[model samples]
Target: MTQAIPTPQAAINAVAEATQQTPRKITIAMAQYSQLPIGRPFGCFANSVRHIAHETGAEGRTPQLIAFPEMHLFGTPGMTDDERHTMERSAATDLHDELSDNFAALAKELGVWLIPGTVCEKNPGGYVFNTMPVYAPDGTLAAAYRKICPWRPYEQYTPGTSLTTVDLPGFGRLGLTICYDAWFPEISRNLAWMGADLIINLVRTTTPDRAQELVLARANAIANQTFVLSLNAPEPEGYGSSLLVSPEGDVIAAMEGATPGLLIRTIDLGATRRTQEHGTLGLNRIWHQFHPEDLPVPLPLYGGRIDPQSWHPRHTAITAT
Candidate 1:
């Protein structure tokens, strides 16, 4: 069960108040890249990295971290349902480690953190899981997040048991969430409470509803007072609208409907701290004002009892950093 977050930004606000480190800023690349032909994964990903790196370098800014859409390692869509099915099943259910190893090596060679996207891995027990792999610049597998909330009645994969986050040495901590998982407020709240300064949401929406997701991206950012980068699959495969949302709930960069584009932005971690220590527009102080007297509050959703010890906000109200 998740700890009580009286409001969305409460946990992050609590975390923001306790920290005193100098603010961190890192440039991140969101590649709303469409799937390629059903073949090897290295070429497409590597080429995209090289091209993007070179392009950004021309602008005198190199992306430190790069992310693609959900299931990006999987190939492009097929014409018929059967063709697409064969393409996906054959690629995802393979018993090889090439995709993982090759990408790991690529990240090391490129010297950039990479979130290539999720895959249906047939791990040791022969059970398939929809998992997202995070590769560090050193090529080590930093973190792999399995999809906890699969699109119900449609996606029948094993659910991930634990939430995952990655702490960069220089940059701030990052929480990972996939597609449908973004729909649940509890997921981001738990991540924010767990000390994530940024949340990366990988999306793969083949149908419509990306508009709603756009709203969720902003809402989650505002609620947690944390940076959120939502990368969606490109064009036809997905209704593209990838965005980089700031802690202030502002859309720093947004792509138009069902179109492919790239976004690179250096985010300020100090903003989250500022917002948390202060408030959204200096008005919403839901995180800083926790009251023990409210323990009797009943939550019918989860047996209607808010634990004071567990629900207590972790930080005291402070005027300044």
Candidate 2:
């Protein structure tokens, strides 16, 4: 039988204290996903997670944590509401249900923490929300975070109101945020303020301006002085820039667009602490230098009124349903 993993609170305190002494090396696994069927997606995710864990171990490094991209098990991007709902239901995995249990079993078997990036959750409101579930090595549920922000035309989906952070046995406080949430600086900054040492962003973004958004993500890490693990979807809708950024804004590991593979990296918590204590590189300097009031105001381009029916080509011949 496998040993039981410690609870989240206990793990957090232990890892936080460990950071003051020796630098604990934690492995972050990023899995990229392509548009595929439900079974294929789950299989691909499972293989990638297991492979990365084994490969890192073979490299003489024990992987303490593995993370996958947003909606890795279930494919995203359906055209209509009915289609989307059907896909979501077909691909949805219950948190304490069978699918979650499968991942829990994987964590137990591998003895590694698993952050299954974001899964499509069936909410009570007859809508689906993107959620992230963290599992302990002993196959226990550690934490779950729902995406606070949903993308455009996704108003039909329920919005999440809470942010969550959990502790891993070998890793420090881990924060969870989904794709669209990364676009909101307040979310990450608040997590940092709440004592999160690492922020995991699971994304499936297909926008043309994603590269620019990555710059913002790096800024969040630099400004917060915390490690960031961002995993992106591989293809068909996502421009994969899956990456790991250090507290000082260094791109430690980055994968190019739509690449289906695992990107593994070791994070040193002590280094992050030292950088903060020195008051030269991390949050200390940012606190001393930047002020919110000093920021420039965003100018309004077009009027507040938006007539989608008049401007949108898709709505040109549409009638209200």
Candidate 3:
């Protein structure tokens, strides 16, 4: 028989209790892959999650969190309106129902929190949003964060408006952000202000920008004085540079390229606290120390008449003749 999902509040409590105690060691799993058949990715994702946890646990290290890349379910672009609608209606099974249950069950069974990165979520607006849902160890939903900014060519997705964080019992406060959102510094600052000690960046990106972005992740961690777990998908869909950066901007664990596997490492939350306490001078420095206002804005590349198609095709042909 299956078990019931816990209320959001209960899930919050479960996480809060887990973080409050000591020893502060946690393992994060990042699964990298390309686009697969519709709904086929979930099976692979589940297997990867289970395998990573088992391997880490075998090493006597319990995985407190497991994270995947953005839009792990719906694959990449190519859905028509009708197909999108179908996906929206069947979201429970296709997107969350089974995955949530499995992760919750796994979290309960393995005693670890699962951050399944961002999934394709159908909102009431008839558009899908990239959203991340966090599961506590007790088979409960702790928190969910939708991507605030959608990348180019994905203007169809609805943007999220709120910034939220969840308290994890043994991990301190946790914040979630997906792919493109990491490029925006304000989002990370806001989460830090909200008391987030650990931020999980779930991404699916391509090269030749992968190495550069990995550096950015480390910079964000050092600036925020918090732990950053950047979980990315494998190529050709994404450049796999899954990394765990410490509060002082040290790369604790990382994996490069489209290799299908997991990178397990121990993170000491106490070190984060220590960095924040003793490194206040470095941490408190303003980001834009240089006067950005001194730079002038560039002119527009093109300026043309508003109505370019006003001339009829027949008239243009007659003029040419």
Candidate 4:
């Protein structure tokens, strides 16, 4: 059964109890790969992961967590809306099953925690979702999260309603989100508020937007006082600025915009705790200030695709043709 997280005060207590002993060093592997064709074979990518794991898992140090970019399995980087829709339907039916199985096997062989990016997941009801699955070292399906917000109007993938976090035994708790989900600060903040020590945001963004994505991720890390890993694909179609950010808002390790290789870094969780304890804004204080009173929650109705007005009142229309 999944562990139920308590309120903010309880979360702080959990962190305090968990941090009694000196935290162990966790080696993270950020596997950067070039974007492939829409219908590429899953085995090709699985083999690539196996090879990288073999190479990195040699000698004394092996990565504890290995992450890949979102939509790493099949992508339509330069497709028209009609083309993308058609391909999405075809790939959802053809590829999701085989690829998911291979990822499980790969994780078991590697003996490491794996987040093998997002894939087109077909539900029993025929709705498709962009889902990211987390695999434990023994090949068990630890946790999975569907992309809460797909990329604007371009991808019409189904959005998931809930969030999930995975526990890494002795290491710490981990939060997983895919692609555009990072754009919403609420997602990462909720994760951290729930006692997640690390938040991993996977993406397949373009080169021009890489810098913006990095800054967004960095801010998320600093605000939450948690380590953030933003893993992205390689250029030219995809910018490979896969990043690992410390709780102090520092970029600990990152890949170049066009590089395709593994970035391995050993991080200590003590720093994450230290940052939380001595934060610029005290989390405990803020939590208490907002918690006692009965408050009404407001839900805004008209900002996104649901808006009846197509034209922007303040700016020029930038909708894709």
Candidate 5:
């Protein structure tokens, strides 16, 4: 059964209690990787992760979580979107079990949370969706977020419905988004409203539109007051510019060109809450800006209304996308 979160105070308490044991801080590895050839062994990925782990240990810190680019699980660099879709459709059934299991086992063996990028998942109804899965250190599947906004016309895949978030126990709630989904502000806003402190966007772009995506990263972070991290594939297949933005819209880290490199940073959890409590640079508290007793404001475009009452942070705990 889906668990509806409790009251506003109770929700905050739940998050606090879960994060009380350790400092709400963690090191994240944003791997800007290009795809290996179609027949490459999974050990290539394992070795890549191990290399990052070794470097992280050299810095006197272990990797707690690591995220790769959007198409990390399939296709070689330089493939067209049509080619990727073909590969995805062909391999959806054959590769799903093996790839997902490998990622889970990798997470368990490394004792790190892993987002190994989107898999081509076929639902029972025979529709395929671009799905990203999250794995806990214990090899359990923590969450799976489908790409609600698949790049359209040229690239076709069935879209997903639900917004997904995962609690990190000692850290904060992390929300998931895929490549083209960055264009939609509602997706990020809903995640922030659902109590997500950080948004992980997995991207793969080879076009000029990537410049606009960089702008959206900062815009979403500042507008929603949450930390935003985006990782993209490199060179031939992608524009390769990954970004990390702070709650105050500061560019904490970024990659400018099409190069296969990694971005590593230790992010502070609950920075969004702190920003909300103290205001952004002591200037704006967007989440608290609304009147508690205000009536719902209808929007004809969305076919819905905004309710002040539903603005509370008590988010549902269901994990699937």
Candidate 6:
């Protein structure tokens, strides 16, 4: 039940009014960066971001939107014990003022919408949440989405309580979900149902199941009939096949290696409308036929009257007086 922020709509209207004629095509860039040290996450990340802007800006082709990978402020997945200790303290201390303002300034300076992926957002009580904040070209805070599914024992960050979407000028509505959130199909479907034209997966994958995740990405695009952008970190632990899948489940562009590089592509926004009108396997039609009120949620039907104590016999025995 994440509430829609008023800023996105206001920004969308402002852009639309300013640009007059709606843009049919948009350029998007994904920066697949080598992981930086935890001690200097902000400075290192800013440099990598500038690399993308420089490469594209020099070509006289500044992207409308730029995407970065998840949990950037905390470094990558495999950090040393000292690194982790340093990251934890830094996150709890300067996350709000320093890290946030730096990214905002970057977007404003470059004049491009930037998704500087997940920040280790710290709360007043010393608790942290994995959050992604979207900055508009004018350095305005457009929208932010917290990671709904934090990778369990490996990442003990707080789970998000809601789903949120942001509206771009002519890009239609944009949805944000971080790494582990890609594994849950329901969340993507929900975003699509809510009218998200592009669903961006800001990921930090470090597992051997990269192939499986690739399939899942295509499946998500096909099912939702929306463009899917899977941006991954280029860490040694990261599987750097960052991809952009179209509504028809086509891989538009994919990074070749775990090297520092940029995946730049111009996509026809009009294609999203055309492809979704007649979805693959008629999914769009099928989606409209179901009503939430009609669905039934029944209790566990297996006549389960067993005592709670019977479930964990070994644990009970171990703790017995």
| CA-only RMSD, every prediction | 6.5, 14.8, 18.2, 11.5, 7.7, 14.0
Candidate 2, 1-321: lDDT as tens digits: 996756656654554554576555676666665655465645565776777777763246757788777776665455576786677776776587878988898899888888776777875566677789989999998888878998867534578899788865444677788887888887987787665778888887777767876897788888777788778877675888888888777898888867676766777754555444443232144433433344443335533432322221110111111
Global lDDT of each model? Answer: 0.76, 0.70, 0.66, 0.73, 0.80, 0.72
Comparing 5 with 6 on TM-score, the higher-scoring candidate is 5
Clashing pairs in 5: none
lDDT of each residue in 213-319, candidate 1, tens digit only = 88999999998888888889887778888898987798888887777888877775556656766667655654555565555657798775655546522332222
How close is every model to the real structure, measured as TM-score?
Answer: 0.83, 0.77, 0.72, 0.77, 0.87, 0.77
Best by TM-score: 5
lDDT score, residue 75, model 3? 59
lDDT for residue 179 in candidate 2, whole number 0-100: 82
- Please list the residue runs of candidate 2 whose C-alpha ends up more than 4 Å from where it truly belongs after superposition: 1-21, 39-44, 57-59, 76-81, 125-127, 282-284, 287-321
Model 3 Cα shift for residue 21 (angstroms): 12
Q: Can you tell me which runs of candidate 4 are displaced by over 4 Å? A: 1-21, 57-60, 77-79, 93-96, 280-321
Clash pairs, candidate 2, are none
lDDT of 5 by residue, 14-74 (tens): 5455434334677888889886665579899899987876566324676789889886767
Q: In model 4, which range of ten residues has the least summed lDDT?
A: 312-321
Candidate closest to the true structure, highest lDDT: 5
What are the per-residue Cα lDDT tens digits for candidate 4 across 152-260?
6877888898888887776777888887888899898778776677888988887487788889999999877789999888876577878889876888887776678
Off by over 4 Å in 5: 1-23, 57-59, 76-83, 93-96, 315-321
Q: What RMSD value applies to candidate 6?
A: 14.0
